[model samples]
Target chain A: MIFDTQRAIAWINRIAELVRADVERLTTLDTAIGDGDHGANLDRGMTAAVDALAEKEPETPGKVLITAGRGLVSKTGGASGPLYGSGFRAAGKAMRDEGDVVALSDALEAMLRAIEELGGAHHEDKTMVDAFAPAVAAFQQAAGATADMHTAAVAAAEAAEAGLAATVPLQARKGRASYLGPRSVGHEDPGAASTVLIFRALADVTAE
Target chain B: MSSSANGGPTPPSVGIVLISHSAALARAAAEMAAALAGPEVTIRPAGGTDDGSMGTSIDLIGTAVREADSGGGVLVLMDMGSSVLTAKTLLEDLDDDDAPAVRLADAPFLEGAVAAAVLASTGADLQTVAESAEQAWSMRKL
Candidate 1:
C-alpha cells in the first residue's frame, strides 16, 4: 500500500494505456458537447508523459508524478493539460509531504483543490470536479478510518465512476460544453469520464 | 525593458499578450493591433495549442507572457473557455519577484487586444493598459 517511485511510475503508465484504449469513446463523448479532441489530446499528453518519466527516472514517488505532471503541462494540447497537470503536480507535492494512507487522501484533496481552483468548478458543473470531488470525499473517508491505501483507492475509484455516471443527467455549466446549454444533458461529460480513468488508474496501481 | 531606464527613444511602457483558440485569429488580431498601435509595443499572439489545434496551450501563453513583459508588466487578453482557464493557471504560477506583474483582462478578445495594444504603445503603465482593454467589455458593436 506504500506508494513508491515504481508504483507512481506504474500508475502513470497504466493511465496512458487506459487513455489509449479509450480514446475512441472519449472522443465520441467529447464530440457530443466539447471541442471533439479530448481523447486524442489526452492520449498524446499521457504518451509523452510516459516518455518523460522514463527519461527523468525521478528518485521519489512524488517526483515521479510531479515530473509526469510537468510533461502533461508542456505537451498536452488542451485545457486538461494544465488542469490535470496542475492537479497531479499538487497531488505529487502532497505525497512528498506525507507518505502514508493519510497522504493519499491529502494528495487527492490537493488534486481536487487544484482542479476546482483553476477551473472554478462547482459541484454538478459536469466538469472534472463531478468525478474528482466525490473521489476525494470517498478516499478521505476511508483514509480517515485508517483504511489501507488499496481500500481507500478502491473506494475513490468507485466513487469516481458513480460521479461520472451522475454527469449523464446534468447540464454542463462550465467549459466548452456549457455553451450547449440544456442540450448538454443526457451525455456523459468527457472531463468527468477522464477523471474516472485517473482514479481507476490509481486504484489499479494501489491494488497491485 | 524600461523605456525610462535609458536615454534612447521610449519603448512601450507595458506589454500585451492576446490568447485565442485559433492561431490565424490571434495573428490577425495582433496584426491589426500592431498596425494601429505601431511597432514599439510588445505584443505577442499566443494562440492555439502547441500541436496546432483549436485550444489554449499553457506553455504557449506562458512563453508569450514572459516574452512580452517589458520592465513594466504584461496584460493578457484571452478568448473564452480554455484560453481563460489556461491563462488563469499561468497567472497563479507567476511570481512578481521572478517576472513582471500580470493582469488578466476580461473583455472581448479582439477589441481588448487592440485597445490594450493602443494604450501600451502610448507608454501607459500596466494598470492603465489593462483598464483600457477591459473597457472593451462595454464596447458596442452597433
Candidate 2:
C-alpha cells in the first residue's frame, strides 16, 4: 500500500515523462496502419496534464489523477485522450474518499476497471487493454504474495512490457488499425506500447 | 519582403479538426498540427471516446463544416471508419439552409494538414482551400 498523495503525483509525472520521451517511436508504430499521431497526441496531452498539475497540485491522489484525465481529454483532442482519460477517471473513482493509502490490489483493480470502462476494450482486443489487463492482474496476484509495493509495481511493469511484446503477433480488433484487418496483424499497437511506458514509469517511481 | 520577414503583417488563420475513434488519438493529431501550425492558427477538433462515443457534437461539427463551406469550402479529414461516417452524417444532418457547401479533402492527415495550413496561410477561403486539399490528395495518389 504505497498509495499516498506523493506516490500518486509521482505516478502521473512518471507516465507523463515516458510518453513525452517516446512520442516519435509511438508515432512510427501508429503509422504502420493507423494514423501516425498516437505518440505526438499522447505526449501533447500528458504535457498539458503535467503543466496543469504543476499550476495547481491536488491534495489527494485521486484529485491529481482526475485532473490529469480531464486535461488529456481537453488538450489531446483524440481517441487516446478519452480512453486514457477514462482510465485515470476510473482509477480516481475507485480511490474516492479512500484516504491517503490504498492497497496494491485496490490500485490494480481500479486501473483495470478504468481501462475497461474507458476503452470499451477487452483483454484480447490487442489494444492497450492487452498490456494493462495482464499487468494489473499480475500486480494484484503478486501483491497477495508480498507486502512490498515496489515488488508489485516491478511485477506489474514487467507484465505490461511482456503484454506489449505479445501484441506484435496478435491482430487488432479495436481502433483505426482494426480497419486494416489482416494488415494490422504484424504491427505492434502503438497504444499498447505507450501504455507499457506509463506502467514502467510507475514501477520506477514506486520502486524503493 | 525583408521588412515583412522581420515584422510581417500577420500570418493566415487556420482551424484544425482531428477525427479519431479514440479521443486520445484525435488529441494527438491536434497536438501535432498545433506544433506544425504554430501559435497563430486556431485548431479545432472533434473525437470519440475510448468506448466509441462521438468526439464532437454533430451539430457543432456541422457548423464547422458549414462555416468552412461559407466562401471556399470545408476540408474534412477523417482517421477511421466511424469518423468518416460521422463526418458523412454531419454533412447529411445539415438542412439546405443550414448546410455549408463543402468538399471532402481526401488525403492522409499529414498531407492534408500541410495543404490546409498552407492554404490558410495564403488566405484562401475555406472552400478554395478544401478544394485544394482534395486536389492535392488526388494528385498525390495519382
Report clash pairs, candidate 1: none
All predictions: root-mean-square deviation over Cα?
2.2, 12.3
Query: Against the unseen true structure, what C-alpha lDDT does each candidate score?
Result: 0.87, 0.68
Task: Give per-residue CA lDDT, model 2, range A8-121, as digits (tens).
Answer: 788888988888888889999989967787887788779878888899989887788878876775556456765676567567767754432235457557867766764568
lDDT (Cα, 0-100) at B112 in candidate 2: 72
For model 1, the DockQ equals: 0.66
Model 2: residues with Cα > 4 Å off, grouped in runs: A96-104, B1-142
Tell me how far the alpha carbon of residue A89 in candidate 1 is from the true structure, in angstroms, after superposition.
0.9
Candidate 2: residue A129 Cα off by (Å): 0.4
Worst 10 residues of 2 chain A by lDDT: A96-105
Candidate 2, number of clashes: 25
Best by TM-score: 1
**Interface RMSD of every predicted model, in angstroms:** 1.5, 8.1
What is the fnat of model 2 with respect to the true interface contacts? Answer: 0.05
Return the top candidate by lDDT.
1
